[model samples]
Target: MSPTSASEIISALLDLTAWTVFDVDPEGRILAGNDESGSMQLVEIAPDGTRTQLTALPSRCSGRYVPGTRRVVVQHDNGGDEQMQLSLLDIEPSAPPADLPAGLPADLPTGRAARLPATLVDLTPLVHDPAYKHDLADVSAESVVFLTNRRDGVDFDVVVHDLATGAETPLYDGGGYLVDAVASHDRRSVAITTLSSRPRSTQILVAGGEIATSPTTGTTGGHGTTSETPEPHTGTARPVAVTAADEHAHHIHVAWAAGDHALVMSSDHEREFAAVVRVRSGDGVPASAETDGTVWETLVAADDHDLEVVLSPDGSAMVVGHHQDGVTTLAVHEHDGTHRCDVTLPDDGVPTVIWAPDSSRFAVHLTASGDPGSIHLVDAATGGVSTLVDGRAQIPEGLPISLPTVHRVPTPDGEQIPCFVYRPAGTARTGDENDHAPYSTTGNAAGTTVAGASVVLVHGGPEGEANRLFSPVIQALAGAGFTVLVPNVRGSAGYGKRWVSLDDVDKRLDSVADLAALRAWLPELGLDADRSALWGGSYGGYMVLAGTTMQPDLWAAGVDIVGMSSLVTFLENTSEYRRAAREREYGSLEHDRDFLVTASPITYLDQLRAPLFVIHGANDPRVPLSEAEQIAAALADRGIRHELRVYHDEGHGLAKRANRKDAYPAAVEFLTEILGR
Candidate 1:
């Protein structure tokens, strides 16, 4: 960032309001940190021209033990901007000298904001594995779940664990593709969907008391089948009532209706809300069909991602959530059309509708008249709203962590593109506190902050939309002190049709520009735009490469995690499902090769001036290891400085503890050395 005057260069540093940023030693001791973000420092110079602070940075003083081989790996982006980082020797712990009076204020994280137990910052660093798995992802009901081997050859039953206790229990032991699973109310039962390679019937498994005990499997993970009936349960199974019938009646609800009937909320997988179905539990035999049991849909144009039907315990009214571009909302329904009024969240956040067991008040997320984000519980009758929990709890202690700033940037077509940017905690625009709404402060923010450099974090799914999920990497980087920006660029979902379709086909390159604009705009907000770096995984991995390659002069370094380095290789190696579906975004390779090739980042590799690091998994079925091999081969052949980190046992993204243990350290060293901190 430049100084007060645009022309002159400033130190590109700021004093933080919360815990300071630190770089520590291998023995869990403070090395160096800025005074603003963390505690005061006690300086001690080491032989290797090193400076160690008595009080460690937030990343260093994590109050956790680190084994000799493992180090708390904190990655700073350096923003990968053009300029070199400031002097690292000057950084040390921010604590006051020991001679100072003990009467001074005591500052530390103690209450609910306390750090996770038994975990250190340097525990697992990011590695540039070229073959890391990105597809084997699971959203667990508990913060921590049991390990489920997600490889192709290894056929193993998946066991979902209890959130409080790590007691593992069987959910499904399928060999075929098991995309997702949700446990029932009693926690004893669960609903899982399995599909064969041929897109056959997506069988839903209800492991009530019946399917939990017996497990004699013969087939491999590439394919498996649910017994026509579930085996009896060994012990008492928790009774969980699932109402969601996945699209196409694949695997909807696993309820205990009519003795052992599972109620599923299903629809056609064509991304439409045509037919919603209810099936018997355990066996997927359809018990009934809604929409008047008619073949044709009343709302053909309705935008339905998945069936949002919440069936009442009495089986009378089912609250169905539907979206029709003009009107996206939830309504109470039965065999007839909607029975009650429709309820919509603010900007339609795909509301998570939780009905009381009695079905009186439908607790959901909603937008208040003048509030940025407010949670409300509505009376099912009058539709009157009452605020239950306001996320705006005054943070009397910590840093000023802001929510995502939603801006509608102007595109070439004069259309407004809604972009979400989350600034680091304790960092914000210089204005009245109340003028700016409390930022959602979602996703992940690293622990510490770099003095000058910031990272432009990218979200995967080129078609994926950003949400308020707990992100470890983002939090780690923020703890290490790097400003992060996650943009919901074109091709991302959740938006209307036009917004999502923006990155389809020839218009794909626009994502790169939208990102570059983010890079340029950061400097205007007191961040070091020129010193920023680029990092992301999956399609985000692709973006990291595109960021450095297309804007070669912009980033000082690039970190690609399970990203598509070469579209051609990715397209050639990916699964048939992905190859067919990805065409909507990149265009069908068989039909429009030229148009798809134009959006491929490999088309402009020669433009990559920044040092690049690419990581991937060997068993990635979606984007094969060949994508990394091609890019690595090209970079090596071109004599361009690069690093390739590969994980043989994983696919898409890293899952194994051993893989992350090695990978995260590599990322820290690379970012630190390149970022010059």
Candidate 2:
């Protein structure tokens, strides 16, 4: 077969549709959905892998089955504005008049195999505000708990909606923003995680809105500064000091264990990496609270990377997912955090694991370097695994796939950057180690010597991560005979928190330095430095623009997808709900304006030598469309070769399938032309 063209690869990938599993039913079936027409239609997957569409609603909705009931409580919103409403869906099959059961619970678990008429019960009347967004917290037998934020408020207040009467009541207001809330298995208490006390800080609160603290006050620790413990709450709930109240500390709720009497969470309080700790209800304050003592029970210590835990329903065992380097490592552990054994998952890819309702089995969605990916089933008892669904099932036949090879490049600053390298399928790996022969001499499958260009694919989030996953865009570039190097540069998550925060605020230029270091080391890996292009979306896009401007001659071309050109303007224009979080990552607009302007890509545009291509969604809320417009206009006026493509119906990123189908191929063509393909 001939090498796949850029257009061929795009078509093969866009032809497939991907479904993400959200909730699992008691019958061991899966609940998954895909977004269409700006709404997600929930579907039921039988044990035999057959999928049946369950709901047909006009608005976007996601449903969670009511415990022990045939009804699913759905949270939906109009036109994707995210102001969600509660609705009950009864999917029980229609029965004959004589077979009707008497006194059924207000909500019941519905049949999986039978095609039932979905009855929509509007619970939106319970919430008076039409502009407030609602997020499902916990669905209990008696009530449904959720968090709601009005247009006028910054924090989300927890509310409980009773199933029988459809009455809603306010539960708690943390004074700060609510991060997450989980009801105990027993449903007696709810564990709420909040970041209200300080910027990027975390606090855990048990039900009744109580703040648990030590009996004695004035403990010294956290930032090496002595902190006077706040007075313990004598109200319905107590605030437990899982970590010190340092402004830099961030806690993410993992799960509630020991029958809801304890909380399991991950925190980077004083450590470089994040660790998982299980805090009992009355610990008052963690030992880390006492100037010099061990932190909470230390369920799972960080091993140079971030650790995340998912406890089974019974809390007897857990799957400890460790993000080391750039890949996920799954290991089984006792509920108390003792090492049990390892559960092997696909290497060098992101794995999303979901437990069966009974916890006896788990479904892991793994996406590797090529093709879309696959969902695998794992036996909890033996760590055995099997494929449950192939994410690449819809790919056209005879399309080639490329896998990524992981390598670490050491920087002068002593940081080891992990790079995922993808050489086109037939590229020769047998070249001499000492020859220093570049990629131009590599032979393709057709046995012809091809001068392979290289492209640096940066990922977004800066705080987000770029794992080894099935990226159609990356593979398409490689299929067109280009070598792709995706680096999880500093400030990227999955690495230790300290490394992620290294590029924060004024130190951002250090990360751009890492890009120069990456390009300099390319020749050693048999890649061409002169023919390389810089490409990324979001934060990665920011890096592309910055790299070309800061290190003007390093890249042959550049692509930015909804990336910010001016950090100052971005903060002033981005969505209100995201401004605070963005400030925490990029720095404050009011006080750090000078630093932001210095770090902005636009400030250094005069140094750019690479031709550029910019893509954006007209409706982007995170980095507004104006960010792209300003940069494109500036580049045009400067007489630099550039092109800008804006999708009118898109937002923050290219989400719509049709738009991606058109945008990606065009992007490939642009890069290929500039790279001399």
Candidate 3:
């Protein structure tokens, strides 16, 4: 039989999906985002790793198990507008599945013994404008707290709902923007954090029923859209300041700690890096509380590296995740930040630590170089690790899996760029498997010695770092005989703030120079530099355009996925909720139009000589479909070879499984045709 081909790898990847855990119940049942039927839905994973489908929502849904009840509160939205609506799912054993929600595919399997039957209850009816974005903040047995932008489309406000009475109460409209909210375990009070005073200060609002307020106008009760002036009610809410007004502190509320008495958060006040701090959760009546100030104690101090904290469910322990040069290091400590111990893992990548209800265990979505990602159970007390779900289980047996080697490629600016190099494995073309001819025939082009066609894969989030993880696309390319290099360039997260901020605003082009340097460095690693291409999504997509345009002679081809073509236009016509945040990374359209145009790839499209392929979602709210359209139009007018794919059902990225399957293989085919590999 022939060896597995790139197409086979892509097909196998289609059947694979990674689960992101949201919450865990006392019974050890976990609520998570999973793709059981090609669409993301809520799934309950038993303590033993047994999987059970919970909801058949048409779109992606994030869920949390309601304490002491058989209920799960889920947040979902229409298409990909990100305006989520809250829904309740009664996941009791005897719950009937009759009268399922409309638009649920008729072909969905009716019975799965492992799955508890569930009934969907639309909670959106409690809010007036379901058109605005709503997010789940916290859930208790009797009530649920959510943040919504229904009142003003710009800032989010806190809203609490009683599960039993269906009574909705507006809590804390202290105005600015609500960053996050966490309900106390006793359900008597809630702590809300506002980031209105960014980069310098923050306010923590603690409120109870005494401080609840609901607007008198715009009560749509899930029906008409008559905008009425909501009679605002001022509750006895007490505001606690975490940082001084003059300090450059950025306070981010993380979670409720030590029952309902305190909260855990990250504050960069008077420090270069953000550190964890535990603040007093004042009594419902703030005037009577005996706390000296808002901040009670510093749980974790800011060290040389930035910190990410994950508190145990019982608030007994905490996990500190920090990164250096793109690899993550996790340390476990007591809830009070004592007794620290580093977690021993087999590989290095960003592992999201989700603590179980008992605080004795944690589930980590672990990933490594050449491995997509998998869910692993970690012992909180002993720092032990074990696999719960193997994300690569979908790969066929006997296929040669590729692994990456870390290469420290030095840049021109005295920086060492960490690059993960994945090479194709060798296989016997005929007869016994022991016959070790290079597994792929595609790489042995003329004048190449033991080297393969190369591709530089850039990751998005100029603020995000690339980690060693299993990516089907990278595997497929390697299987097709290409040497794939993924670099964590400047402006990537996980590498301290200074490194991440290197490409911000006017310094953006320096990262493009690093891309060019990577191409020049490829030959030293025995990879064919002349036969290489550039591919990335989002910011990485933007890198692809930049590399192909500014360093046209360096790349054989380029593929851009939902990348920005014109920074100025993107800022001018992106979703209002995201425009300001994006402007911070890319220059602002209002004040820095000329700077944005200078940084944009569309401005230098005439310099691009290589063939290009672009993919985008028509309804993308961030990058928008116009980014792709404009580039495709420009390339066409210039007579450049290119192909554009616009998926109607997708937004931001190719999130739909069917769309990914169709899009990825087509990408491989395009590279094959253009690079002749």
**Per-residue lDDT of 101 in model 3:** 90
Question: Considering every candidate listed, which one attains the maximal lDDT?
Answer: 3
**lDDT over C-alpha atoms for residue 603 of model 2:** 93
lDDT of 1 by residue, 513-620 (tens): 777777766654466667778888898989888888778878888788888876766777786535644554566678878866766778888886787778887767
Task: TM-score for candidate 1, please give it.
Answer: 0.50
Tell me, by TM-score, which candidate is best: 2
TM-score of each: 0.50, 0.84, 0.83
Order of quality (TM-score): 2, 3, 1
- Poorest 10 consecutive residues by lDDT, candidate 3: 215-224
Off by over 4 Å in 3: 1-3, 93-130, 174-179, 185-239, 244-253, 259-262, 266-274, 279-304, 340-347, 384-386, 427-451
Worst 10 residues of 2 by lDDT: 216-225
Computed on alpha carbons, the lDDT of every model, listed in order, comes to 0.47, 0.69, 0.69
Cα shift from native, residue 577, model 1 (Å)? 4.4
Worst 10 residues of 1 by lDDT: 79-88
Distance (Å) between predicted and true CA of 316, model 2?
A: 2.0
